[model samples]
Target: MTRILRSQGFVTALGALVLALVAAIGYLVVFDPARKTVAYCAVMPDAVGLYPGNHVTALGIPIGTVNSVRPEGTGVRVDFEVQEDRALRGEVTATTVSDTLVADRDLAVLGEPGAAPWDRSTCITKTFTPKSISQTLQGFSQLAGQLTGGGNPGEQTRIRDSVVAFEAATSGTGPELNKLITDLGDALRAPDAAIGRIGGLLDSYSRLMSSIALNWDDIEIVLMQATEGIAFINELWSRVVQLIDSLLVILPWLNSIAREYGRPILGALDGALPGLRLLSANVAGLQQLVSMVPPIVQFFEEVIDPATGRPQLTYAAPKVALPRAEADRICAALNGLRPGHCDGAENGLSDVNLVSLVLGTVGAR
Candidate 1:
């Protein structure tokens, strides 16, 4: 029993010395400058689940931990650590995570360490609360109420009813969506039939156009012939028109010459009309007078001097002298005979045969 008591004392002393050495090591660790960090204050809307100890990271690297939390106003003030060796101008972030990588459980971590508040970087000591404690507590209270079937029982019943209705309404959406897709497919296919007909019509039109193109040179020759015919007709019309104009210009002069000649011709015919009429009337009178002149000439032939036995009227041989009484009578008869009548008588008084009588008459006269 004494040996057990001595062994117990020795074991107690060794344990105490081991504890003192650990304490000394912890003090030295706390005071060391290389492992030392700074204390900073962060303002957050809520504390989340930060406790006494949490890890702080600089750009996803663990640098330090959260120290404490205190209420400032409507928000919580957080005390965190940052290594002094690194330059830090902005505060760090604190969040409650389902799995914590901190030395103490359920503590906060620094969101980013290189963030600067005063150096124009977008670093803010702000927080976005996903699930607030107060909100969680309020949800718990509402769940408790609903479970007890007390206070706002009508709202709870309506909510349960609405969930059932929603599930029923959304359940047939799959079939409805399928029908919609079928109608859309029909609509999309409806235009293809018309497009096929259009393509056929266009092909026919192209064939017709090709046929016309194949005959283009013949058509051009026909057109050229028609054009030449039209040009020839136009030229002929121009020449005919010019000839008509020339005839028009000469017509007046021709008419004037005809008029000038026509006046003298008409005047001459007017004068000749009366002369011709008088001449026609006188022709019968002149014909009758010409017939009566022969009878008077025959009476003169009967009265030819009787052959005288005495020399008074002897025309033969101038032989006998005339008796006084007979000579006187014959001389008177000779004086009465007309010279133009005796000479113009066709049967008896030819000058060639009456030369002795013509000489005796001339000597007596």
Candidate 2:
């Protein structure tokens, strides 16, 4: 006993234990181990595999560990012992997640930027529970089993019959089905052009809708006015129906006339086509010429024949009567090879007025 008490090994061991205890006590004093603050969150009943000592993260970073999780009324109240410096804010949300399907869940707290400060005294009202991978796999399994009818004889028979019918219906259409599939793939792959066109169409439709919205009042007024015209339109429709009946009665005769004389009428039009084309070419000049006709008619009215009680179409330097046929040809004779040819003939007049014959030709009487 004396040897052991005096031994350097025992003394060294004792000094090590003393040093470790002092360091631990210093650490506890410095870190304030007794007074941890907690934030509370009410979590869903199916926190699946969450437990005490599970790491709690805020925004994916570890800020604390779940201190306790216990049933509070209907749901579970989870207390998280968080570092006072890393407390969550008003826009924070807590959820339970796990890294692997079989792993214990961790409470994941997320916070929004620029949110109001979270009060430590108040608990987060709700928690989000994400669907677990096992649940997803179970659902997929159920669907697969259903599709295969879960080995039931009647269901299997029905599935077989349906597949047989489908096969029979498509038996002769392999090439068509192959072509359809190829075309469908091509269409789907080339959808960028279609999508661009659809976008343009949507833009045009949007503009059209906007235009209608802007002019809705005017459109309503116009529609109201159109509604007021329905009575007039009804009367007009009756008259049109009568006119159509009359046309129907005359149609046979009209058709016979067309059949017999269509060629001659078309021939006449063909002959006049050159004149019509010429008139069309000189439309502006023809319009100007037509405008000058009124003045010319007025001038003819001023020159009236007192003796004949008509417009004096025939005017000469010395007035005299010639036969209608002679008067007609007098202008031609004056225009001929002999200059004074008319003077030697009937009344020794120097000339017959050429302008008078022109006026007479134009129905100035």
**Which one wins on TM-score?**
2
lDDT comparing candidate 1 with the true structure: 0.64
lDDT of each residue in 148-236, candidate 2, tens digit only: 78988668676678899999998999999899999999989999978999999999999999999999999999898996699789999
- CA lDDT scores, all candidates in order: 0.64, 0.77
Total clashing pairs for each candidate: 2, 0
Ten contiguous residues with the weakest lDDT in model 2: 341-350
Backbone clash pairs for candidate 2 read none
Pairs with backbone N, CA or C atoms under 3 Å apart (clashes), candidate 1: 56-64, 93-111
TM-score of each: 0.31, 0.40
**183-278: candidate 1 lDDT, tens digit per residue:** 889878898887889999999999999998999999889988998899999999999999999999889877887788878878889999998898
